[model samples]
Target chain A: MPNAFSRIEDLETTVVILSELAAAHEAEKALLARVACCRYSDAATFAIKLALEEGMNNAIKHGNKFDADKTVELVYDISEDRAIITITDQGCGFNPSAVPDPTVDENLEKPTGRGVMLMHAYMDEVAYNATGNQVRMVKRNT
Target chain B: MESSGDLVLDVRQQGSAIIVRLVGAVGMTEATLLGRQLDELVQQPGAVVVLDIEHLDFICSSGLGALINAQAKARPYEGQVRLARPCPLVMRLLETTRLTNLFDVYASVDEAVAG
Candidate 1:
């Protein structure tokens, strides 16, 4: 199975953005703009967009607190069997283990707290690296 | 770039299933396109629908909502809708929502069509 996976295909350029006051919608937009080249079903495309937006949204609002100087790094690695994408931020690391479950009935209407959950649900793998400053996710080529 | 606008929806009919191939972003803007397509299918009975999004790059919650909605609409008629070949980024969203198991994922349109 490992042999079937190929080296990460680097994106043409890193998509980086600086937002202010916890508004990272631009970053989310930028992230989505880059993912527009993926080979997925409409549902999957929506899932990826949601993940990217949610990731960027959390990075901006919760992590960096919307500091303009705090930039978000969006990297895309496209390959034949899979795409390895990573979202990194300059904010202080946090505890990924501390996130709450969003699927519970009471939490269903919450605007947030569901990004990580959703990411894990949609992607094949979702992992945290560098003490929570980075989120690396994988989507198989299936 | 607006990733949520201008999605191209193409429906290709195979034996007993319809392949709904979407190209571009499946964001808020294009979510409705999915709804419209599914609505058209709702009127037709007994045909499975497989959504093909390999050409799509980005997906949002609203977009996923549309799929869920379509699936729900199909359930009553004994017809099912499945997802075909989602991109990495798109897959990430499904995993995040824990919705990977909600819909059957296919490796290709042929596999889905054959099933």
Candidate 2:
């Protein structure tokens, strides 16, 4: 509960819903454009973009299991100093702690375990709901 | 701005090396595409693959994983995967993941192909 996020109350929020991977991609790119327009540095924008991609991919692929019947919800608010994004899927949730660290020797070559790690690494704060179905991430401008 | 989640891969053969130039943002869908293409290329005899990322706009975790997986696939055959001119964002990602040192990166494709 830092004051930085409390400032989120002042900014407008946008919500996007999608059931397909192609749609999710477009939504993510639009979100990134908004983030960049807020004047965040190149690195900060890239970090947010990466986190958003991973978050959306997880919601669509892992959570929904690529079921077209299920939909993913993305809510985001960006200000001059920070960006906050939350993604929720209609499928059963997962335990975030169960993800294996991709940096380890044995897991380093694996291709699928790095999404959660990248989200945590790029975003200033990454939090999962009690049921593990929803994730909220925050990135601040430095 | 228009957003297309398209990840384009342009492959060409230079001597014994296979050059794959990636363009646009890379996500889960594109990762699979890249992985499949790399699998085919790695099977070739003496496949020295060079990934050119100069035109790549963005790359997610799975995209990074695809690159590493491709590199791993080439190693057993005495072939290798080299990275050329990764943008600042991709470079930062590789550095953060601690996988930057695992691959040989060159300034350009000519340098990588020659090396």
Candidate 3:
């Protein structure tokens, strides 16, 4: 079977955790360590860190609604050239296009909607599965 | 001074402004604590809250939300929240979110206190 993350040299790391912010934090720490080991530029590291945080937060909070029974899955491949990550949740997904633009004048003050915007801004590429339960973000070393 | 996991908050008074120095990361877990603390600070009469972020290593959207919420809460009271010494990473986020115009930003905590 062809691996989805075969392009990156490193073996992909997969993590599954209950829909808890604490567990997500742990997963993030481990993944960030891997990113650091790859020696990505400081700017690239910052971008990846911000996007990863937003992606995991959305999966655990918005997607799973913090339901203890629900789980969030994270998969990542980190190489010197780029880092690719996917976060999936065990809840009904919503359309990304339906999210209101946070940059709009009226919505700028609203805080909750900026997560998705930040993910898009910091990542080189962001794509969601058809069901919207999974998000894949890529940050290329620059 | 208050600490929650990776985030530390040190609040001090500088003239009429209340300066809160944040250190470490402010992700999802730390945002709750930051929001609550900012809420309490903004409730003071004519409060001027200055955030010293020189040492803040990281912040996510939730943390930005907390800042916006504090600013909103202070508006009715003729109070405001000012940001000081944002690191490069944080500056990029402020610029990306177009929040640079929404909040008064300064190069130093002293400037924020005076502004």
**Residue-level lDDT for B62 in candidate 3:** 89
Q: How much lDDT does candidate 3 score?
A: 0.90
C-alpha positional error of residue B32 in candidate 2 after TM-score superposition, expressed in Å = 2.6
Candidate 3 has a DockQ of 0.83
- Where model 3 places Cα greater than 4 Å from the true spot, the runs are A1-10
> In candidate 1 chain A, what residue range of length 10 has the lowest lDDT sum?
A4-13
Better of 1 and 2 by DockQ: 2
Q: Residues A30-105, candidate 1, lDDT per residue (tens digit)?
A: 5555456555555555656566666776666677777877888777765445556787888887787787776665
Among all candidates shown, the one with the greatest lDDT: 3
lDDT of 2 by residue, A11-125 (tens): 7466656667788878887888888789998889888988888998889888988887888988888878888899999878999898888887777787766889999999999
Q: What is the lDDT of residue B60 in candidate 2?
A: 84
Candidate 1's residue-wise lDDT over B7-99, tens digit each? 777877788788888887665446667777786785567669988979877666656767777777777787788888988766655665666
* Per-candidate interface DockQ score: 0.13, 0.68, 0.83
* Candidate 2 Cα lDDT to native: 0.83
The predicted structure with the larger DockQ, 2 or 3, is 3
Better of 1 and 3 by DockQ: 3
Steric collisions counted per model: 36, 0, 0
